[model samples]
Target: MNVAENEIKSVMDKYRKFAVYGLSPDPTKPSHYVPLYMRDHGWEMVGTYPKPHEANGFTIYKSLTEIPKEYRKFIDVFRASEKIPEVVDEAIALGGVEVLWLQLGIHHAAAEAKAEKAGIKVVSNRCLIIEHKKWF
Candidate 1:
């Protein structure tokens, strides 16, 4: 479940759909800008946040569970590192999540273990948008 070079590209190529948890309305925020960047990079992004009904001019859902059963493979988490335990638990419950991404500066060993145990590929303390750009 740990990420490797091949796994990263496989997720991007196979599952272009993404749910951005904690997506923000403010452009200045990392949560807001990362998803926007992904959308611009050709990834279909779903804003999953409680505060914003819309982000980057697209409607935002409250959680991954709210997203239709079909789109769950791509998930990028922007929650605090300390809160990752709860977030990871939620992701495990939300079926079909292929990639569990933790944004830059976020890391939780216990949550990472749980996600891996659930057979979910995890990328911790990394930036997906940045990685995409770098690879391209």
Candidate 2:
């Protein structure tokens, strides 16, 4: 279920809680700030990173599997393309994941296909913050 470019906004509107993979600790980084912006806008966000880190006091999972199943509805991925497949696979295994979103400059066709095939809405290479700004 690859979401068309124009439908991204509608998709964004549909989900409230988001699990951001590769979310950074640095406030200046896109992975951090993008989710932060969403959080500030009344969106609920949790984060997962390779290392232990905090994003505005939110519990940052060390891996996707660590996230609670109910919080996996929308996954906004900030990982590089090379790392996406594993994340996508984990998302699928986690279940209840409605959307798989790859952040700006990150795109993995295989991963996208896998998620789409699993009936998860897929959006690639788009900045969530930029998209949110347009619709919110």
Candidate 3:
């Protein structure tokens, strides 16, 4: 969809529900705290973790494929950069993801391109919590 730099702010504002990939249970981790901040600010969150566990009341799906299709609108990925492509592939397979976000310090151009090619907006090297605080 080719989101322009100027349009990113608007795109980020539109997203409210997200599936957080690699979410951790540890309270100190960015993967945990960032999404917790978002949820506290009224965003709906789901977790995609290898283990089944709850995160602040959000259900943890074992995999992206396990998340309900209706809640697959946005995916906040916290995995290593090398693992982004696989996450993007799962998002694409889910068919309803509107955005694929790489947490701050994480980026994979090929995966970003792949998700963008599938009509998903790509946000790389950004913190969702920071963006929300800035824009909302």
- Tell me the whole-model lDDT of each prediction, alpha carbons only: 0.80, 0.85, 0.83
lDDT value, candidate 1, whole model: 0.80
Which candidate ranks first by lDDT, i.e. highest? 2
RMSD of each: 1.6, 1.4, 1.7
lDDT of 3 by residue, 9-84 (tens): 7876677777899899888899999988988888888888898776777789898888886567888889999988
List, residue by residue over 31-132, the lDDT tens digit for candidate 2: 888987888888888888879976787789888788887668999888879988898888888888999988889998888898899899898888888888
The sequence of per-residue lDDT tens digits that candidate 1 reaches over residues 1-136 is 3888666766667767777888888889999888778778887877778764666586688777887655567678889999999988888886687788888999999899999999888988888777787676
**Candidate 1: segments with Cα more than 4 A from true spot:** none
Cα error, candidate 2, residue 89 (Å): 1.2
Identify the leading candidate in terms of TM-score: 2
TM-score of 1: 0.91
Give me the overall lDDT of model 2.
0.85
Error of 2 at 12 (Å): 0.9
Which candidate, 2 or 3, would have the higher TM-score against the true structure?
2
Instruction: Indicate the residue-level lDDT of 43 in model 3.
Output: 81
